[model samples]
Target: MIGALASQAPANAGSPAVERGQYLVNIAGCNDCHTPGYFLGKPDMTRYLGGSEVGFELPGLGVFHGPNLTPDKETGLGAWTDAQIVAALQTGKRPDGRELAPIMPWHAFAKLTRQDVDAIVAFLRSVPAVKNKVPGPFGPNETPTGFVMKVVPPAKPK
Candidate 1:
């Protein structure tokens, strides 16, 4: 079911498309996982988009800090490609070669239109680049577990 939806939409990187994507990301909980922040007892608003490290303490796995989505050359996705952004949002992957932690909910967003996801990337690119280097979280039992969580295939236009 997910695979069929994954191939339906082709994300186009245009001005309006990007803007729409931004709105979707904002309304949805994309920032909750992709952005760097720790919601321990209290929401870590300071580290917005910064990954969280509380994934291990309570639930099943200990999550890491979300990275800044701004176009900062160093600490953010400034270097990521629009396709990469779409893939990450639609497929769950890092621009480089790493699969984003499962905490980054791509499945739900996968249902969004390609234009909407592109809009999100567009909006993220427009954000002020904040210099913050984020590290990957330790996998469950020291073994990578986000792989199975990467079940998001793509999205189908509603």
Candidate 2:
């Protein structure tokens, strides 16, 4: 399975690291939430890994936005070091010391081999830098409060 996953990487034209990273990101479904329009069934490859406005809302936990993974200096990972990237993936802690929401699946990502994680970083670095500033997670103050539930009775047996 790992072999198959790696094979999906792009051709190692300039850097084998970047190719492997692209492949890993694809198989791991990183674009699903990080890349806008992915869930809508059409991803804008031009803005790949540029983050998304549509975020995750986990009620009491808080609302989370997928941050840009591209190398944009102002709004992305351009300022992040390779070690920091690896740390984020393995520990779910951002460079700022804040914890990433569980919706990011950092726990599952922590299981990835070191080489794979490095590849992801390399690939992210190689992409074109997009100046898109993703909003931070909305805390309880900014998020809406309340819950709604509906119950239905069971149908009669035949």
Candidate 3:
């Protein structure tokens, strides 16, 4: 099912970074949450990486929304530095000091190669910027006490 959706976008033609990033984003299933309509196997290309208002409800945790990854200045990552992007993926900490919900899979992503991480950021920068404001996550009880931080292995040697 996921394979059918993987070929929709070819690698970015102009930049190798963007191309690699695009490929990584596709294989990593970033679109599953970051891109609306993607999980249904029909991504809205017009709003690619624009984020979603639809929320995910974790059994004992709470509701969470995916934030825009586009370069939009108002509601996306335009203001974030590439380093910040890498940090978020590694530590699950947003630039504003907020922790991302476990649903973000930062633990798995933390092990991505630095080159891959940089490529992801480059791809994010290359995508069309869209203005979308995702709401903050809401927890049933104060942030889940069962939240356990995982130890992500160091990046693989190239």
For model 2, the local distance difference test gives 0.74
Local error of candidate 1 at 87, Å? 0.8
> Where does candidate 2 stray beyond 4 Å?
1-12, 144-158
| Residue-level lDDT tens digits of model 3 in 52-120 | 656666656676777899999898999999899999999999998988877889999899899989988
Give lDDT: candidate 2, residue 38.
Answer: 58
Q: Which ten contiguous residues of candidate 1 have the minimum total lDDT?
A: 1-10
Question: For model 1, how does the per-residue alpha-carbon lDDT over 93-134 read when each residue is reduced to its tens digit?
Answer: 776678766556778878878767767777777554567665
Give the candidates in order of TM-score, highest first: 2, 3, 1
CA lDDT of each prediction against the hidden true structure: 0.57, 0.74, 0.76
Question: In model 1, what lDDT does residue 124 have?
Answer: 71
TM-score of 3: 0.77
Which of 1 and 3 is ahead in TM-score? 3
Off by over 4 Å in 3: 1-12, 39-42, 141-158
lDDT of 1 at 82: 79
Model 2, 1-158: lDDT tens digits are 34433443433437988988887888888877777555566666667778876666665666677778888878999999999999999999999999898788899999999999999888888776777766657764574222211123568999
